[model samples]
Target: MSILLVDSYDSFTYNLRELIERATGCAVFTVHNDSYQLPAEQDNLDRLISSVDAIVVGPGPGNPEQSHDVGIIPHLYSKYTEIPILGICLGFQSLCLVNGCKIRLLHEPVHGQVSKISLQGESSLFAGIESGFDSVRYHSIYVSEITDNIVPLAYSEDGCLMAAQHVTYPHFGVQYHPESICSNMGAEMLSNFGELVQKTGQKRVADKHLLNVQPLILQFSSSKEFDFQFEKVSRKETLSVCEIGDDFLLLNSASVPGKWTIIGFPEPNTSQLITHSQSSGLSVGVWKGASEAVNQDLWPYVSRFMAERKFQPRIDDPELKDCPFMGGFIGFISYEESAPQDVEPITSSPIPDTKLCFTERFVATNENHTFVVSIRPNDDLWIADTTAKLNTLNPSVSASNIPAKIEMPDKQQYVESFNKCQEYLHSGDSYELCLTTQCKIHIDNTISPWEVYKSLVSNNPSPYSCYLDFGDAKLLSSSPERFLSWDDEHCQMRPIKGTVKKDSTMTYEKACKLLKIPKELGENLMIVDLIRHDLYQMLNKVEVTKLMSVEEYHTVYQLVSVIEGDLHGSNYSGIDLLKHSLPPGSMTGAPKKRSVELLHELEHQKPRGLYSGVCGFWSVNNRADWSVVIRSLFNYEDDLCSTASSRCFRCGAGGAITVLSTCEGEWDELVLKLNSVLKVFK
Candidate 1:
């Protein structure tokens, strides 16, 4: 059945569309009262009014008389006599005028938050309404008395006509907007109208013209030979797909108008998969309708695409050596009646078809078991497409894979860097930078370089801290906060500054003083200013919603600040924010680009990999929430180590320093923050 939602303003029309869609689960069309264009052709309009199951005239900000000027009410009533029609606010006034009711202008029109309504009798529109209920009212003019064909169904406390129904016709009108949330039973009222349409079997205006076919399924698998060919092409072309989970993540980065859309599966019935847990991060998309093409064509292309890249393990880097392969897993419990005395087999498996392969190999181990798994691109990317084939095969026996462990550098360099930082602090080159400014420092000496490489994937990440091991110099940090996260519309940045010692005599005043240091304050203010400027470029009405505030957290106390604004007219993507505001303000200090340059000069290192980057999900709604990669550890396995003994961890920390900063104090701060994680290690 068709429903016409008439409005005089665009906002009203937009809202009506959403309300009607939600209420009826049916497509609805809108018409503007003042438009020179009518809905469809003139002949079509007559047929539409005759066949339409219902018509809903929406409320707007203007006077009800304006609706007559456009002849909207007259036009609707002239052709349709028996159809169920409901009017709201302005529409109600139009209904009253057409039915010969008196329209009286009030000194102050009731507008929002009026009073309760009292139902008079068994009315079609008020079928489910109880005697007394609160509802929003908005109008400058109201109907004073019932018209000839209209029968009053409800009234306001002051005798104002709140609702009236046609005595003989199926027409209904209300002086309040039942489409708004403020209305007591708005959805129920709309749903009642929908039910009437269904019961009457009213001829519906055809809408098949708007229907479109669903897209074909695209699948990937690991058993196809063509997958290897595709891998060769991707590798030769230097295509890069994100290696998330255990599969080689592949995307068409080179496609023109490059857009990667993921459609998730229908909601699963499993309670474990349905819950919101960090262990079971939400799935991206779901597959539907199995097909031969999905198995043969799509799977191979994915497998080949993943094979083209090589994984590079950074042996010298501590963060990589200890990085954990962070991804969610789902377990299934199957019980057989024949084995009633035995407990059902409970097995854990990664979410299907969500795996991505890194260009490297990592030693994977579950619990106490360990084994080396080569994560190189499968001969066929189709292998990654496990949802279809794997489910069809019998479940595997329960057994844990042994993780391989590799040797990494020892505590000698870390000890040396720590001692050097201490010496600098004593020399008085600078005063104490905040103690929380340390970055992750690598400590293990036996993890595979590739295992470290795999830990950079930013899925299912844990809070970690690490010290960057750059032979001659080191950069340390203990970050457990998100720098910035955004989807399409809204963007957020949680900048962490200021720090207090965990076991020190620091009071709130001392903590505030530490943050308020001229150098520290200046640096923080600069970051705020930079963030404001960045947001200004993307958002409208930019404002410092929340200025510098002290937010006490579990592990430490931080001086945090918030800056926000609406995404300006432009449709900004999550990747846009990531590229613009990365390596967090807390880590980079004020004058971001300059601080980074100084960091590069003062600290000897290249890219910090995932250690300093942001990690979070960018949802389809164009919204996202991510945390800065800090207070976390990455774990890699040693390939040479026996299955029983191969796992390591890497933690990091670092602080912003200005020329006024004392080397000795900076070193001490780094150590203090580094201890925040090392203590967890012990």
Candidate 2:
């Protein structure tokens, strides 16, 4: 189905287009608020309105009583009675004004805030959503009273009419933005509108063609040690590898050359994404990409191609099927969209505005069994190569020496940085700052990326550890913290806050003292709040599943918290969830934007690259899981190291800096976080 989205000059109109298209599987065409008036454009506007199945009047600034504020509403209401129309925010007030109702400025205006709503009764637009839904509001005016021609179906806590339908025509209007992240069940509510469009006999059916691809499956036994598997795989080729637990190893090496490229923007429309996958003729692949900043304009997106399927927002409950992890997209999106519109680039840095890679084959193993799926032939699969490669192992050179003395920020220099963070906190510029430093290690051809990954995992067996070998770039991560995860059913984010490394000099009780420290507790609370705010953007009611608690990792006893909420509706995808919670809070600090700005000014290092970001996968079924890129190492192809005297490797390490942070304490924390990887070199 096609939707005509009337843009009314709101900053969030584009966000609305993304939400509606993804939720309804409809083609949304947008036009400016004044497009109807220009003599040259009026003919085009009329033709577009006639062609579309539905018309959505988007939110905007200014008084709705003024004709110029929303001039398109009156024209559409008078001229088009057959098309389904839904209005939002300012458009809601316009709906009221046109239908002989009253609209007035609210005594207390709402801007970027969540409103608790109470539904009047059963309504088509709010079918699957709860009675008391939490929704986002960005308006100064509201529908104060409704006439007999309009029936109110929902109200805000203050008794203002929040939603209503025209008594005679199939028309609806809402005071809150269902397209917004703050609307907990916004996707579902928006999907209800799509159903209304279908009831109008306007559903567009897509043509289906059988997926053009061959399926390949291979399995490995989990009983084999990871070290053994690593050695065997390294001898063959570079592929993507994932550690699900001590038992499972998933590897993908189905290489289709010249298919990879760097992607910059997030495409949230499922229909367009499906078209991209179908056109490529590969039903499954993984896209590892990065964005300099996280905002509507630029987001990291993973297109998980599943058999070149049509847009399927919801699998009917009676016909529901469980889909195993099919390959898809995953990667990190920085806190900002790109460089600020006017800022200059950091000099001589090879890092581009974005970086990504796509892949289509994988081999998975667990304690009880091994599983493999690849697009390649049987002979090219890992099962055929493992035993032979194992027989040829060289034990003498398996353990390489520490290539060179590692260089890190000196204690004194880091202390100064810590003090500056405190000053920013005191100045009220930021609540917390995650100050980080880089450690460099120079190597030669003798260092094996696979061996390094095996060493890091053995030393620090983390729940979210992973390894990726992109030929020119290699990633070895031992991240314990889960950045976020979402299936069609639920959305979750777990942020790690406090840390205290294990020490023989101190008793376990003394070591646990870090959990009880006021500074640590405060830091945890601040991040928890930040996470809650981020969740509310795309969800309705975020629940703190777990509060401050101590969890033991391989190297540190850490304070962690879990916060989660239901996805707005099945219409929402894993990409939607990640976009709402990019640049994980624990790493970025509280009051996100201000803190990130401070880091840009205070930290002297280049853009964080993949460090402190996240890495994971978005499955073909729209389920996803990812890890914060902390306690991790990413190797970019450095011409200087590859062709010159020695090969240099870089890794980032740091901690959250708050007003309560001590210079010595933060430096100690930084050293402790890097210790697990550092030991590999030792």
Candidate 3:
């Protein structure tokens, strides 16, 4: 069977698509609700609907009362009466509204809540499915009054309508998300829909214009050889890469759980890859002297840059193979850097939206395990000198209280923004809004950027902590969230949402007890669904490997979840997938586009800068790793276009404001996030 799932811009649309494909073992195609309305797309749209055996109106944000929100959905059910159809959430409400029922706003909205839903009566949609199952819901509106045509098939524990079916048509609807990872028997529900499709006896030919499938494995290189080819050094001695330097990167994992670190620095002979800026078009190879400029946007530009990476031989050392960053591009993508032209950044940026470095050599190490250095051909003398410098370098970097002042948005201003976010949440404009505020700090330049990075890691060692010195901008990050990472086989994303302060009395058990409730987990759940949607494309199957687990950090306990999907053939490159999933879902909210739009109005146009952006490396090998830049302080070279005697630094902090969030509590959380990094100044 071929199913055409009309996506209503919901985060879980892909989740539903995968579920149907898994349950029915059929080819499924999808299109955005407003996708084909254009005059040029009408014929293609008609051909698409005619090609599918069944149509599923996917759930999404907003009310069915608004025709623009639901798009061609009303026409699909009304015009194509003989075709089997299934409506979910927004789709469900759309079905009810067309059948002469009203979508009423819930007095108490349930954005990311789980509840028991019991079957109402005998119905083909619920046949063979377990009754009274826990299903995840992400809706703020409902349909309670059923007329003769609209019949309730299931109801929640509190008696709100959960599932319904049309008495005279092959149309069905469900209030809860059947495709949620946390929801039970989702496959069974989709299977029942398949059976209903069969009973309808619709004989339709599959569409020839199916979406092309791409290969998962990515392979491409600029040249057959790099400035330095992989070779082994004769001497074996552990060295400290902690020594501070200019235009270098340290992916520090010191004291962080189950982590490795990489120190990336440029070799003089390979100076072409010092800095990356997307402000203007890029010239491909300055080393060649007659290089050509590439006229592409940020993400596409990255894809080409990575595709043309210099080649390096494989290092068999168990240490180097496991580390994803064996030395490549190291830099930060500013928060608003990749925002499409449609979404204008509120804050005027102080620096280019992006800054990256291509390091020729790097050292990978784990304190207790192994230290592996990348060796190139004809560089024995350089390696010996570097090894000697690292061996004799002092590892101890003491913390200092160097006086610093912090600036912030006042309580009233923040509270007002918080209140506005609440209104948007209740009105269904967004499920959760990540409201952010930037803090400025004036610090004495007596301390170097590398020393400041050492202080950050010393104060709050996090799994994704790192330091970047790009000459123009220096980043000191102690972020704990892994935004996205990929190897040859699969792509993984770990999002950190909930936060709890750590004290002497806080135990792992206590943290779990305090952080596992519906209110606390709701924010995390919305982002989880959003990320699943983001990654659902080009996926064999996505899994929530770790869900809602409270992990301890230096200053706080956080609720983290890991979601991963296998990368398919060369159809999509690592950069392609990374760019497709921009803005990091956790930093945004559910129904991401709308939430991002609403946040523009709520955040008062303050630039998030590097905060909430991602930083890491894309290796010469087809692999990459990045961490969400958070809990960090950063500085751009002053007006002199160089580091000054005193530097002006910025720290960004924010909290996800959901319907359950209180203005004061959110303010406190924002303050806590800010203090987590600012304490390094002490």
Ranking by TM-score: 3, 2, 1
lDDT for each residue of candidate 3 in 1-682, tens digit (9 for 90 to 100):
7888888777778888888998977678887788767557768777887778899999887778887888888878787777889999988888888898876778778888888989877987888877889999888788867788898888888778999988888889998998887888779988988987877566566776644434323456556546443333332222135553443567776555636677776654353442234444444442212334556555555666667764555656765556666557777787766543233333233355576666666766665443435534466665666666655566465565446767776788888888888777776667788888888877777866666766667777788888776655678888888888887678889999899899898899999998998888998988888888777766766889999999888899999999987766536656766776778888878787787777767766555667878998888776788889889887777523124466778888888988888888888888899888888774
Q: Which candidate model has the greater TM-score, 1 or 2? A: 2
TM-score of each: 0.35, 0.54, 0.91
- Of the two candidates 1 and 3, the one with more favorable lDDT, higher being better, is 3
Worst 10 residues of 1 by lDDT: 331-340
Off by over 4 Å in 3: 38-44, 208-223, 227-245, 274-293, 308-312, 341-350, 369-372, 568-570, 638-645
lDDT of 1 by residue, 448-511 (tens): 3223332321211123222222111121233446465443346667676556674467667667
* Cα lDDT, all candidates: 0.45, 0.60, 0.74
Clashing pairs in 3: 214-571, 215-568, 215-569, 215-570, 215-571, 216-568, 216-569, 216-570
Measured by C-alpha RMSD in angstroms, how accurate is candidate 2?
13.4
Window of ten residues with lowest summed lDDT in model 3: 230-239
Count backbone overlaps in model 3. Answer: 8
Per-residue lDDT of 513 in model 3: 90
lDDT of model 2 at residue 624?
Answer: 63
Best by lDDT: 3
lDDT of 1 at 4: 71
lDDT (Cα, tens digit) per residue for candidate 2, span 1-682: 8887876655456567767887888877677667667556778666676677898888765577667767677777656777889988777777778889987666545544567889998789989777888886656677777899898999989887889988878778898877654467777877999988988885643222211112111111222111111111223212222321111222221211111111111222211121011111212122322222222222312232222321222333221123223334434333233222223233233333222332233443332223333322242434445434333533422353355567776777777778887666654345567888777776665666666766666676677666655434456777888888777568778888888886666555776685767677667766775676565444545677887777766677888888887765534455655655667768777456556666776665356656777766655455667768788776666534343555566677888886667787888889888876788786
